[model samples]
Target chain A: MRPRPPAMRTKRRYILARILPYGVQVDQKQMYFAVIEAATSLFGDAAVGLAQPAVVFCEGGYVVVRCRRGAENDIAVALATVTSVADERIALRTVATSGTIHALRRRMKPSRRHSGDEEVKIGETYFAVYRYPRQKVDLVEKGIKHQKSLFFTEADLEER
Target chain B: MKITDAGIRPYPAGDSTVARMALEAAGLGFDSAVAIGDAVHRPPGIEILRGAVIGAASVKEVLKRVRDPAVRRADIVYVDAGDTSFNRAVVSIKEVNVVRSIHAARRNAFDHVAARTAAEQGVAVDISMAPIIHLRGTKRQRALQRYADVLSLQRRYGFPLTISSGARSILGQRSVREIRGLCALFGMTGTEVTEALASVGWIAEPHRPVEVVK
Candidate 1:
């Protein structure tokens, strides 16, 4: 065997984020570009370069980003600022962050799936609705677009 | 710590209805949100405080309006800060809870005097996130710089700073963590951002003993 290669010393941190418009799937490359663009816009070229952000994984509308250890917050902010991807409006909510993927996964609760049907009022009219995971709700409406969906979280229905 | 988005505009003109906005705020983990409009029906689960945005061209007009019973009773009184004289006058008064949009003007609207006075009188300076989200290119850069300057002055003078979405629609509104991250871009540390968010409650109820988030 050749001489053992020394272990890489670069310390890194992982960030767990949930892509909103929930169920809208985006390519990992697109998510990566959006994040980089946001970081560049917010912190300028030089600072973002130092952060060295990279999308390590993307699946099921969840993304894991890796960056320099101390740059987690910078990267998280960049991810938050990404309002769109491939011209589609979206939101990336930072859920959990950790030095190890194991820890991050442990901290992240399982995403709940919205099921069954309910009646919702939009404007003055009432429409039958179907629920899905990731805050996506589908409403049956006439004379609209291809689909009528609303992504709302529990906070959207909370009482004062 | 209770997080609050202290400057949300709702209703027919805005994208989200007041009830929806309140629910969205609560869902995003905000304890309360101050809606900037006439007192409307309250939503459940979250505290929705009624607030007003007073835009006056002169100091006298602002002073006169703040004295009005309706304006005084409002949970938060946000005066337009684009005019230099108006900004100066607003910061001098303790009753004026927030001076809104200091960086939206053509020039740097706030100066050393205003910052100092704001600190002395315990007036919270409102830095709305709407312009930053809407403006682009050089305009956006200038706004960011102005905001950084305000943050620096805030650090030096110990003035209260409250960050708001200034959102006209539900999409425009940001969660508390998102706002804190944006503030970090302007050079605020995590601790500083926490304090800024906490200031919203203090400004809304100055008489109550407020706890500062570490």
Candidate 2:
């Protein structure tokens, strides 16, 4: 009988290796994972760009990621994880630190072309993204299912 | 009650998939189909049948099949078979087109020959029709226009021509009577409208949803 190949499904997720929020450590990690998992199941493998302890823009009670590829189908599926496509036409209007938004604005200018992929961290969630305009995408494993493979823990991210 | 026009339909491939899809459509919203097919883009379902006459390898093959007369009991029959009367009131269709596929030259009946056969049959054949049309531009339309030279087969053979919007969407399918009326709008004779619809073996069984048969 022909054996099945290793799981080569089109999607992947990964957990962060650092402490995101200090005093609210364990609670923060749980909240972040819950949101990401919800985002993944509904959105399938195409919508998520990044993972936990990531700098995601929390706006209107929603998490936002800077996306540059795919559309509504991806958005609705990844609802738990707020994401957006930033084109040359629009700048990132994130509600994080004003500096973050300003930084994105400068780098996203038409002249400053990017590789079109992204990965960031904010409080306790790791925000990750697949590259924009990519014919193929790569997503990492997120949460406990992938805990063994992880090298970093919550304690590692403390601001010593 | 279910009617379709193939001339204006935007089918993916003009092959059996379209015909099967047409059959599937019968279940979705129709019980019959006014299939509009030509050798070039006609669906392959009829061809798949072992002895389906519509699967003739050539014009001669079609003639051979038609002459057999043993299997010609298409549920419905045509009245005039030329113009709108040749294929108008068909309740559903079996599409026979494959996108961008080459077709047998002799098998293509988008000409006067098929029309001549209908003309020869006279008023005896009863078929509702969705007129085979020719347009100035567009893929299928351009293809028709390219074959316009051969269309004389329908004319030379005495088959009449009519107009239809080849149905591809629920919004695309037209009412049989309204389509016939539209043919009349285009100056087709009454006999032409009746014969065209009957040509495709359209049956009125108290309006059942469309279905697909192997």
Candidate achieving the largest lDDT: 1
Model 1, B1-214: lDDT tens digits are 5677878888555745676667667767788888888747676788888888788888788878888888877899888886666677778876688888777764657878888999888898887777666555687788788889888888889999887888655667777777877876677787887787778887766765687989
DockQ of each: 0.20, 0.01
lDDT of the structure predicted as candidate 2: 0.30
Residue by residue across B14-75, what tens digits does model 2's lDDT show? Answer: 31223433433342333335433221223322221111114432333333444444434332
Worst lDDT 10-window in candidate 1 chain A: A151-160
Model 2, A13-123: lDDT tens digits are 211111111111133334345445535543345445532223244322223333322332232223312211221010111122121344434333222112424543534
| Model 1 Cα lDDT, one tens digit per residue, A1-160 | 6754546667889999887654566899998898898888877899889889999888877889999988888888777677777876677888888888888767655555454356667676555554554343444443344344443333343321
TM-score for each candidate, following the candidate numbering: 0.78, 0.24
Error of 2 at A155 (Å): 57
Error of 1 at B199 (Å): 2.1
Choose the strongest candidate by DockQ. 1
Interface RMSD of each: 3.7, 23.6
